[model samples]
Target: YTFGVGLITYLCSKEIYVMEHEYYSGLSIGIMAIVAVKKLGPVIAKWADGEIDKIEGEWKQGREAELKVLADAIEAEKKEQWRA
Candidate 1:
């Protein structure tokens, strides 16, 4: 998604340069690039962090549930052996 947006912006800037050289000046492009990066950087960071948190929560829950099941099975086996 980022790549696609960057490609389209590049193509658009090239077209703008061909149409009006002054509008595509270095300062203008640099400022625009900085603003876009600043705006997107925090959003991407928050999204990535959220996904990581969700995955970690799921892993912890899964491990606890698995351990509980194993412990129950062991207890049942021990009870059965004692009764025999």
Candidate 2:
């Protein structure tokens, strides 16, 4: 959606300059760029937050599984030592 707006702005600006005498001033163009980035900032932040959540969840599950494996190995070792 943001890309579409930026593309349209760029195309329109080029067409206007070539076909007509109209031109976008540097300040106006800079403002448009800033607006686009600001508008998309929230969406990008949400995506990043979701990604971090998924990674943290996976890390937690992996740690639990590893701890269980270690516990089982230790129990087996203790039983073997007792039998010996």
Candidate 3:
């Protein structure tokens, strides 16, 4: 959204001012980038945290399955020892 507006602004500025004096252009871009980060940073952080949670859940499920398998094996070993 901001990028689109910035692009249009840059194109228009280029056409009107020939972009020879690039300070304004650079400033506008810098400002836009700062605004973009300020606006999107928390959203991005939340998304990253959601992704981390998903991976952690998957890891926990895998560990639980492994634990179940190990427990079953241990139970069988104990039963065999009791029979012996």
Candidate 4:
């Protein structure tokens, strides 16, 4: 949008100059940019949180697998000791 604005500004420089720059184009652009950011912020945050949750779930699964392996080893050791 900024690029498009720059392009329009470049193309209409003479017309804008003739208008004596009375139009609050800069202010309007700023307001629109702010509105866009406000609207997108929550969506971006939600996407980031979803990604973090996926990574956290993978880590949890890995930890659980490691714990199970250790538990099985300990059980086998206990049985060996009993046999001895």
Candidate 5:
């Protein structure tokens, strides 16, 4: 978008820049860049949090599954000894 604006500004330079001395164009571009950053801040933060949750959830699930398997094996071994 900034590149698009720059290209447009260059193309319209003879008319816009000639009248305003490029200050207006520069200010518009600066304002647009700041607005874009403000808008994307929350979305970026949410994306990071979602990624962290996915990674941590997988790790927790893997640990629980491992513990369950270990407990089941121990129970089975005890049953076999009791039968003996």
Candidate 6:
């Protein structure tokens, strides 16, 4: 940036160059970027949270199925032992 400014100053025979227009333009762009992130942050987080909740629910179902299978196996073993 300094090099660009120096080259422009040298070419124009001026110590200061035009920055007012670009500065405000850049500031506005930065502000817009901040606003966009702020507005989207919660919505994106909610979507991610919902996806996480869905995955958790799926894991819970799988865990319940595994527990049921274990319980059934135990019940069958107990019955067989009683018969013996």
- Which residue segments of model 1 deviate by more than 4 Å? 1-33
Go through the candidates in order and give the C-alpha RMSD of each one to the true structure: 10.5, 10.9, 10.1, 8.9, 8.5, 6.1
Q: Give residue 24's error in model 4 in angstroms.
A: 10
What order do candidates take by lDDT, descending? 3, 6, 5, 1, 4, 2
State TM-scores per candidate: 0.56, 0.62, 0.66, 0.59, 0.52, 0.63
lDDT per residue as tens, model 1, 1-84: 999999878988878525466756877999988998899989999999999999999999999999999999999999999999
Deviation of model 1 at 55, angstroms = 1.4
lDDT of 5 by residue, 1-84 (tens): 999999889978756545564877899999999998899989999999999999999999999999999999999999999999
lDDT of each: 0.90, 0.88, 0.93, 0.88, 0.91, 0.91
lDDT of 6 by residue, 21-79 (tens): 78889999999999989999899999999999999999999999999999999999999
Q: Which candidate, 3 or 4, has the higher TM-score?
A: 3
| lDDT (Cα, tens digit) per residue for candidate 4, span 37-72 | 899989999999999999999999999999999999
Q: Please list the residue runs of candidate 5 whose C-alpha ends up more than 4 Å from where it truly belongs after superposition.
A: 1-37
lDDT of 1: 0.90
Compare the candidates by TM-score and give the number of the best one.
Answer: 3
Candidates sorted on TM-score, descending: 3, 6, 2, 4, 1, 5
- Which of 5 and 6 is the better model by TM-score? 6
Clashes of 5: 0
Return the number of clashes found in candidate 4. 0
